[model samples]
Target chain A: MTVKELAEKMNLKIFCGETNLDRTIEGCYVSDLLSDVMGNAKSGMAWITLQTHQNVAAIASLKDLSCIILVKGFEPEEDTLQHAVEEEIPVLGTSQQTFETAGQVYQLIC
Target chain B: MVFEYPVQGGDFTNAGTVSSKVKKMMRQLGVDAGVIKRTIVALYEAEVNIVAHAYKGVITVQLDSDKIYIKLDDEGPGIPDINQAMQRGYSTASPEVREMGFGAGMGLPNIKANSDVLEVHSVVGKGTTVEITNNF
Candidate 1:
């Protein structure tokens, strides 16, 4: 599924990079722990989590994830946003819980 | 390119910066994806532990044709039990650290999983040294 479709399906707000919404998502990982997400989420996969921190962007960069979806409408710190912009990681915000977003992504990708 | 990061203690905000820089350097160096990724993940988790729990430390990264060598040295309270600390989900991080998407006790384990070679040495009340080499 494309990032745009996942956003619409999960009712997410585009914090940045609405242009790449049509990019295809290859996999999904739901985790707040950076270690687990990196170990489990393969590159080019979408990471769904409630974490919004600089470390999250750092992890995304290291893990080479396609994008990050912040569930439950969580707001990231300004530094986190800046880092995401610097690292070129597309970030999405959603009012849905982590499980809900996972379900939506599972339907689309799996 | 060679890189070195001075990790300050208790500064969760700056945690993982070294690993992040290493990620970019690996990409710029035209290293393969898996090798670049494995090194970054290994080094970053160790760096986070330094920032969160240790007194202070420095991380040095050197890239070569065959391997990326990373060394992390810190003056924090050393691990008393290497066997126990290596366990997944075993963390001494404070609650505040947990709230920041860390302290889930996966730092050491993750580092080991990502590196081709891993070695750790520590003395209680002294410090720790973590050396990781990821082969390309």
Candidate 2:
């Protein structure tokens, strides 16, 4: 499914990078650790994390992930949103915590 | 081609800038996707190590047809036991750094997993140098 589809299905908020919401989601990786995401996340996966920093956006771009889904109603920091805008990698949000969000995302995409 | 970028210790904001640039370069050069991914992962880990541990550092990237060689030389309190540092879950990062989702002791292991060759040299009071090479 594409990012747009997943957002619609899961009621995720698109904080930035709306232009690239059409990007396809190949899978999902749920991790709060930066190194874990960096080491294990695959390209085209939707990254679910509590990390709201600009470094999260940087890792999403470097790893070529489809989008970042902030869990538990967390919003991206200002600079994080700015970087997401610049890189065109969607920074998404949801009110649900990591576990619920990850389960739902897996069901939708898998 | 060779490219060098400077890294400031504790500069978390700009940690992955160099790796981003190098990823773009590799993409433009039509490097294999898998090769590019591995190189970026390894390079990024090394780059963040400098920002997290060293006082300052320089990252040198040498791209060739067959392989990419990256060397990170830093000035700081160097690792006293390279072997111990290489083990998973061994980190000396400050609490502040850990709060940012790093220092889980996976940096060097991640680097080793992504790169074909990894070399580490350090002196306790002096500094550390990490060399990573990945064949394309």
Q: Give per-candidate clash totals.
A: 1, 0
| Model 1 lDDT per residue over B21-80, tens place | 787787887999878877877887898889888989988888898789999999989999
Structure candidate 1, residue pairs in collision? A4-A21
The CAPRI quality class of candidate 1 comes to medium
| lDDT measured at residue A90 in model 1 versus the true structure, 0 to 100 | 80
Model 2 scores a C-alpha lDDT of 0.94
> What's model 2's TM-score?
0.98
Q: What is the lDDT of residue A43 in candidate 1?
A: 83
What's the lDDT for residue B13 in model 2?
92
User: In model 2, which runs have C-alpha deviations exceeding 4 angstroms?
Assistant: none
The segments of candidate 1 whose C-alpha lies over 4 angstroms from its true place after superposition are A19-22
TM-score of each: 0.93, 0.98
The candidate that wins on DockQ is: 2
**DockQ for each numbered candidate:** 0.75, 0.93
